[model samples]
Target: MRKIYFIALLLLCGNLYGQGLPGLGAGTTPNNKPILHGKNWVAITGKPLGATAGAAIFHQGGNAVDAACAMIAATSTMWDVLSWGGETQALIYNPHTKKVIAINALGYAPTGATVDFFKSQGMNNPPQYGPLAATTPGTPGGIMTMLAEYGTMSLEQILKPSMELAKGYPIEAQTANAIEAQKAKIKDWPYSKKIFLPHLGKEREAPEAGEIFVQEDLYQMLSKLVEAERNALKGSKSRKEAIYAAYDRFYKGDIAKEIVRGTREQGGLFTEADLANWKVKIEEPLHVNYKGIDVYKLQEWTQGPALLQSLNILENFDLKTMGYNSANYIHTLYQAMNLAFADRDFYYGDPAYVKSPMKGLLSKEYAKARAKLIGDMNDPKITAGDPYPYQGGTNPYLDILKKNQTKVASLSPGQINSTLDEQFISDFQSGTTSMETADAEGWVVSVTPSGGWIPAVVAGNTGVGLSQRMQSFVLDENLSPYNLPEPGKRPRVTLTPSLALKDGKPLLAFAVQGGDSQDQNLLQFFLNIVEFEMDVQEGTEAPNFNSYQMQSSFGDHEIRPGAIVLRKDTPEWISKELAKKGYSLEFWNKTSGPINAIWFDWKHSTFWGGSSDYGDDYGIAW
Candidate 1:
C-alpha cells in the first residue's frame, strides 16, 4: 500500500515541479531536539564546550568567522578527534564580496614521503598510524590565514577561549575513554605518552572522566602563538600582518625546528623545510545550480565535489514524488551517490597537480549519462563513467579505468566472518569533527577540520598531535596516479563542508565528520531539506542511508560494492526489498554522521540551527 501511494505521489511531484520543492508532502518530521533559532547569531560544533567557546567569541562582538575560528581552536584543544597539528578546511560566505570562498589548509605528504619510500617498507599503503604517517601540520597556518583575510578579530582574541581550556578543563568521558582505550598505542610515542597517559602504570592510564585534564604543553604552545601576535602588534604591525607573524613563527621559526626534531626522534619524515614551504590556499569554490539553489563545494583535492555530482544527477528526477526514505527514495539516493563516488574514486585528485576534468563531472549532460547507468536493482558492478566527452576533452587515463574495472571484477563480496566488516566501517567513517557559525551581518562559515585523532605521536613538547593523514595515499598508480604520495603533494581527503545560496544570498551552512560517508550522507541531508522542506533540525536528524560501492579513502582502500547501511528502525519490508536487489545489508543505531547545519530563513531573517543527536554535537544561539 505504501509503495502504491509513493508511486502516485511521484506523479503529483512531476506536475508540481514548477511550484518548487516539498510540493508533494509538507509534513514536518519530528525530532528529539528542538530547532535552535536565532536572530543575531548561531554557533554549533562537535562538543558543548566548543559551542560555548564560539558563544564566548560572539559575546565579545566577533563575527561568524571569528567565532568559528574560536570553536575550531577550542575543539582541537579538547581533543575532539583533532589537535592543533590537524588540517583545517572551511567555506566562508563573505557578505562583503557576496562570494563563498574555499580555504584549503590540508597538509601534504612531507619530505621523504614518496611512493617508493613506503613500498620499500613493504607497505601497500602508507602506515595507517604513528610518526611515519605524519604530514606537515596545516591547522595553525589555516586558522591564521582565514582570520587574517576574512575575520574581524585579532589572533590573540580568537585563541583566548581555547587557551583557557588548554590551561584546565574537566575532561569529557568520550576523550578520556579514547585515551584509555589507546593507552598501549599512546605509550609507544614518548611525548604522546607524557601527554595522554596521566597514570601510566595504573588500570586507567588516561585521565578519568570529569578530571581536570590540563595540557600544560598545549597551553604553552598556544601562548607562543599569542605572544608572537602581541610582539608583532607592539611593533606596529597591522592586525592581519600580526596574525601572519604568528603563522610564520609556527612554520619557519623555532617552532618549526622543534616539530622536525620531535618527528625525527620518532622516525617520521617531516622536515623544517617542509613546514617552511607550506602555505594555506584560498580558492574559488566549485558550485552547481540544482533547481534554483546553488550549492558550493571544495575542489577535487577533497571528496566534496562528489556531493555536487550527486546533486547534478538527482536534478533529473522529481525526488518529492518518490517520498522521503521510502524504498524507492533510498534506492535512488544510494544509486546516485554510488555513481558519484565511483567517479570520485577514479577522477578526483589534487587539482593543482592533475587535470581532474571537473568541468565534465559537474556537467548536466554528464550527470544524465551517469544517471542512465542506474538500473532498477542494485548494481554490484557499478563503475566510473567517462566524463571527458561531455567536457570536450579526450580521455588520457582510459587504461587506468580498465585497470580498475579488472580489479573490481576480480573481487567477490568480502566474507562476513573476516575482520573486513569492522575495517570497512572504520575506514568508511574515519574520525573527524566539524563547526558551523552564522551571524546577522551575513558572515557565514562551515568547517570540517580533522586529523590528529587519538594515539597520535606528539611533535616535540608542543603538545600538538601529528596527523595520520598519510594513510589515505595509495602506493600503486593504478589505484590513483594523481594520489600517489610525493613530497609536498596532498592526498585526496574526505573532509567537506557545505554551503548553499539562492538568489545570491546564503541559504544554508552545513558540515559532517565521517570519512567516506561524509558526502554520501550529506547528499541525502540536503535533499531532505530542499526537496522535503524539513526544518534544519529535522533534516539533520533525519534517517539517511550509506552506500559503500566505491573504494574507501582510508586503510586498505578497498571497495565493498554491494554493502549498504541503514537505520536499525528501517522497516522490515525495506530491508527485504533491498536484499532482493542484491544489496548486502548492515544496520546501525544512527545512520547519519555527526552533522551540524545552520539554515538562514530569509523570510523571517533568522537562523535555524541543527546539530546531530546521534553524536555529542551541540549548538548555541543568541
Candidate 2:
C-alpha cells in the first residue's frame, strides 16, 4: 500500500507539473503571511522599523530613490546587522532613465592592506574581527553619492529618521541578545564596550529588549552630514550640489579625520587619503534576458551575476516539466547552481584591478556548454568552466586552476558531526540585511547593504562600527588570482541586489540577506514566481534548498563539496533520492535567506510585496 501510495502521488505531481511546478492555487499555497497590497508605494526590508522608515518617506512624497536612502539610513542606525560604516550596493530603476543602474559603493582595502601584509602577520586570511579587518568606510559616501545622483530629498530630510534612531530607539531582543552573546568580543574593543554594553560587568551587559539604545556620537555624526548639506543650500547650491557638499564633508573633511583617528588608534591601516580618494561608482549594471524577462545584477564585484549564469543554464531545461522540489528537479538546479558558483568563486572579482570574461560568461552558448556537463546525478567533482576560449582569449591560469581543483567528499549521515555542521553553517551563511523600496512613479530600488554587523569593533569614540569584509579576500593567488587583497581593490562580496524588467518595465525588484547563500536564494525565489507561477507571498514562503558546494565568501572561505542543505519538512522520497545521488544531505529550519521582494502587478497597476517568515523581515504598502 505504501508503494502504491508513493507511485500515485508521483503521478499526481506529474499531472501538476504538466501545468508547471506544482501550485495549489492561492489559498492552499504556503503563504505564511498575506501579500502587502499597495496601489502607490511599497517598502520591504529585513526589519520592521526599516520598512516603516521607507514607508514614511514614501508617505512624505519621496520617490523610490529617496525612500530607499531613508531606509538605508534608518536600518544602518538601527544596526540591523549593519552600520553606517558598512558598504552599500544597490540596483535602482530610475524612472527618468527608464533603465536600471548599479551602485558600487563597496569599500576598498585601506592603505597597507595586502596579501603580503596578512602573510607577514602569520595569517592566511585577514583577521575576521578587529580594526585590522576593517575596510575604508563606504556607506557614507555611497549614500551621499546615490542621493546626489538620483534622490530629490536633502540630506537633512533623508537622514531625519536615522538621526532620531541614533539618539535613542527601543532595541529589539534579537539585536540585544546578539550583543550579549558576543559580550566577550565586544569587551575586547573599549569603544564598543562603552556603548554596546551599558551595564558593564553585569550578568546581562547588553541592553534588554525594548531598552532605549542611544549613541550620542552617532547622533552627532548625522548632524554633521545634515549641517553640511544645509550650509551648501544656504550658499544657493542646487540640490545635487548640496548633496555632493555633504559627500565631500563625509569623505574629505572632519568626518574623514575622525574616522582615521578612531581607526588608527585601534591599530587599523586607514589613512585620511584613503577616505578622501574613495568614490562610489555609478555603474552600468549587467543583465541577461531569461525567457521574456530581463534580469539586471551588479557587476563582478558581487556574487549577483552567478544567478544570471545559473538562469542561462537552467533556461535550457523545461523546469516546469520537472516539478518543484522533486528529486530530479532538485538535483538539476543544484548542479546548475554549482556550475555557476564554481565560476563565481574563481572569476568574479574587482574588474578594475583584474579582467573578467563576463562577455563570455553570460553568453547563452557558454551556458549551453555548461549545461551539457550535468549528468543524471550530482557532479561532486565540478570545477570552474573556462570562458577564455568563448571570449577569444588564451587561458592564463589553466595550470594553476588544474592544480587547485577542490576535492569533493560524499559523506553519509553518520559521518557528519553535529558540532562541525554548526560551525560549517556559521561560516557559510554569515549575516547581512536587505532593503527594498518602490514608489508610484515607477522607480524601484533593491539594496543589499552589509558588513559592520553587531559585535563590531567600534572605531574609537566615533561610535561607527568598522566592516569585517577584509576576511573575504584570499591570501593565495592560486585560490583566486583576481581576488587577492590589495591596498585599493574591492573584495568580491556576497551582497547582491536584483531587479527584473518585463517588456522594458519594472517586473520585480528583490534582494536578500545571507552571506554566500544570497544569489542561491534569490535565484530560486525568482524561479518560484516566473517558473512555478506562485504569487509573491507564496513564493516568499516557498521551501527552497541551498547548495554549499562553493567556497564561502566569509570566514576562512571554506568549501563543503557535495553538501546540500534542505528544509526539515522536505519529502522523504526526495531526500532519500538525493542521498542516493551522492549528496551529503542536511536538514535546516529555513533553507533560504530572509528574502524580500516586490512584484509589480502591471495589469492592475499596483504593487505586491513579499517578506519571508524565516526572520524579522517586514513589509508595508500604501
RMSD of each: 3.6, 2.8
TM-score to true structure, per model: 0.95, 0.95
Error of 1 at 401 (Å): 1.2
Give lDDT tens digits, candidate 2, residues 190-301. 8888889999878899999999999998899889888998899999999999989988988899988998998898889999999988889999999999999999999999
- The runs of at least 3 residues in candidate 1 whose Cα sits more than 4 Å from the true structure, single-residue gaps closed, are 1-28, 406-420
Against the true structure, candidate 1 has what lDDT? Answer: 0.87
Worst 10 residues of 1 by lDDT: 12-21
Q: What is the lDDT of residue 155 in candidate 2?
A: 82
Identify the candidate with maximal TM-score: 2
Tell me the spans in candidate 2 whose CA falls farther than 4 Å from its real position. Answer: 1-27, 405-420
Task: Put down candidate 1 lDDT per residue, 1-622, tens digits, no spaces.
Answer: 9999998675644322212245434334457877889999999999999999999999999999999999999999999999988999999999988999999999998988998899898888998889888888989988899999988999999999889998989999999999998888998999999988889788788999999998898898888999999999999999999999999999998888899999999999888899999989999999999999999999899999999999999888877777777677778888898899888887888787886989999999999998888778987777787888998888899888888777667756553221237767887788799999999999999999998999799999998998989988888878777678889888899999999999999988999988999998788888878887877887888778888878888888887767788888777877898888878888889987888999988999999999889889999998
Model 2's TM-score against the true structure: 0.95
